[model samples]
Target: MALLALSKCYYLGNLDQKVFLNEIKEIIHFHQEHHNLTRLAYQSAWELLIYTLIGEKFYEQVIVIELHFVRETRRELEELSKCVDWKRKKVEREKETKEVIVLMRWLNSLEFFFRFCSFWNEEFVGLFGNVVQLFRASSGNHREIRGECIDFFREAAGNKIMKVEGLLKGGAIDAVLEEISQQSLNEDNKICCFSFFLELSERLQEEKEDEKEEAKRKVFDKMEEEGLDDCIIMFHHFLLEEELPFSYPDENLECYFMPL
Candidate 1:
């Protein structure tokens, strides 16, 4: 299922190299022990695609550093697993994860990391590309959170949900949205995703009159330090004069803030 989702990640979004390598390592190691090389290879390829997408998010220099780490660790972990014939060690490490996923805690570490990345750009976006989604999923115990965000909101907002007879055409998403959107999901995810949407919408609005006034103060202060306040005028201030833009309709998109 992860593999299937990952296969679509490339055209869908990108990830940072460090994040990609770490995530790919978890994915590869999980199924590496499988008896069928074919299945494992398929999963690996999908993970590689995801990694490459993530790699593209970074500059070449940063990616090179992370690639070295990924290669080194991949080799080291492979060697470590081989040197130990003890099934107990493998079981111990895997069991410690608490979840069925490989090195789940390590993956859990990525939550804060992706939130940090989001401050940069939404370009590296995908099903689980945003770490906050992972947090809402495990911490809140919402198994369908991914489905809610991806299957329902993101994809619907993206216009990706097609005419499926029961599942999508007339599905649980329809039901859930009716309830949740009416009064919000009342879950952590509801607060998080909805808050994100609200913030994004507000950001789309260029600085308000008060914000412009506050911004003028800061700019003028900086200009006093640099002696360039009069020399600097707000260029490309169209946002201040125009209405906030909205994401356009598509066959595969959902309106995350439609509740408004």
Candidate 2:
């Protein structure tokens, strides 16, 4: 299986590449093994985290790379969402379905990476939306990944090349911000969430400045109608005093993440 081969590389790759690949690697990072799977795969829980991100240019390349990831990661997240009563097979099926959600998060990162590359794939945008549907408050990883996706899109709100039109058009931002407020006040990720909302607020300022008055007015009016003031207040309540990490737009994006 492509999974077995990739697992070898994933577990044994040079430190540089291992660190590089870890960012977009899904939590369902590999297929199941018989032994102590989690420990064997990740001795340090923090090691499982995504830190440094790698961006690419072309949609086709993103697709190919992500498909490879799927081939390798296909085994762990299979469960059925359709079953009312927990049938044995249904449990098995939704576990698989969970992988689909994980894959969408991976794709979301790829789409962001491609903001540096020339290739654009509309399917990835659509894929991101599909993954959000599977986000349930019951699942921990799902909740985490969904938050990360929200942060990613919030940053992407002003992206010139590929704004997630569906999200912006459909009001997903408000829905997710509301969800974030309802979540447990887990302190670990609070800083990250605060940073993301700040980024969104910054983008809103930019929209007010760059776009026409009518568009800006409409945006503000929409925010008012949808309880965005309360959401913004919620964001401020969560904000910490620490400095947020600032990442500037890549000016020389034509080459860096572009497919070779």
Candidate 3:
């Protein structure tokens, strides 16, 4: 309840700015010490913290705070997949559902934060890797969060502002592309995977011919080896049928979309 109230203060700018920031840092520190990752209450409070920080326009501060516990936080998120008993009654699953929702909201806030903040350095590479882990863990449950994970990949991979070198170092491309090859994912995730391929294909178009060919070769070779060469055609059809989610679809992908 205090965290929620603090969020309002932070958003409304009702408190002294430095004091509020320090209090936020202290509050998160307290939560980290007191809240076990398995508890829905912990997840809820953590989500509110992220919400408050982003609402207060403290994106860099949030990044710094999260980076401090990135590995632990990621492990907690991945553990969510294991802790839930899906066969339990709906009433029993309520807590798990709420935890997933809170985590998803936290991830959504991170995605929004990254949009306005440039991540060009090695310090920010963990965020990219966390997204990949979250993507893998969000599978089989929490479809909405899984979709949001793919949305992050699409944005990060497609956006020119995002540095390719950093993403590569973080293994975002290989991880996501490997996920695209997996057959067990749900339909929403499949669509998202296809969308990621389309966005990546279009992004590569901006590179010089030789660089683009080398990159495409690497991506296509991986896809082909995985027996998902058809995904290339499927993504192209999505563009042609106007099913892709991009606001502005690239028209030059037909050449690349040709059978490999």
Number of clashes recorded per candidate? 12, 13, 0
lDDT of each: 0.37, 0.42, 0.58
Tens digits of per-residue lDDT for model 1, 44-125: 3434433454323453223224333234323333332233323234334533321223223223222222332212321222
Candidate RMSDs in order = 15.9, 16.5, 13.1
Q: What are the per-residue Cα lDDT tens digits for candidate 2 across 1-260?
A: 33323433425533454453444244333422332344224212112222122333332353335534223322222222231122234335445343344344453543344334333344445444443443432234445444555555544543544444545553546545655576574653454445445545556555544555566457667778988898655544554443544455654533333322
Candidate 1: which stretches are off by over 4 Å? Answer: 1-107, 118-123, 126-184, 206-260
Clashes of 1: 12
**By how many angstroms RMSD does model 1 differ from the true structure?**
15.9
TM-score of 2: 0.40
Better of 1 and 3 by TM-score: 3
| Candidate 1 worst ten-residue window by lDDT | 158-167
Task: Extract clashing residue pairs from model 3.
Answer: none
Indicate which candidate wins on TM-score: 3
Where does candidate 2 stray beyond 4 Å?
Answer: 7-56, 59-125, 137-165, 205-260
Residues 1-260, candidate 3, lDDT per residue (tens digit)? 55444444435644454555565556556767775334444444444455445434355456455535455456555666465443455454535565566566556655654554443336557777777776665555545665687777766766655666677777777777777677676656666666667766656555444574587668767878899968877755654676323344556645434432
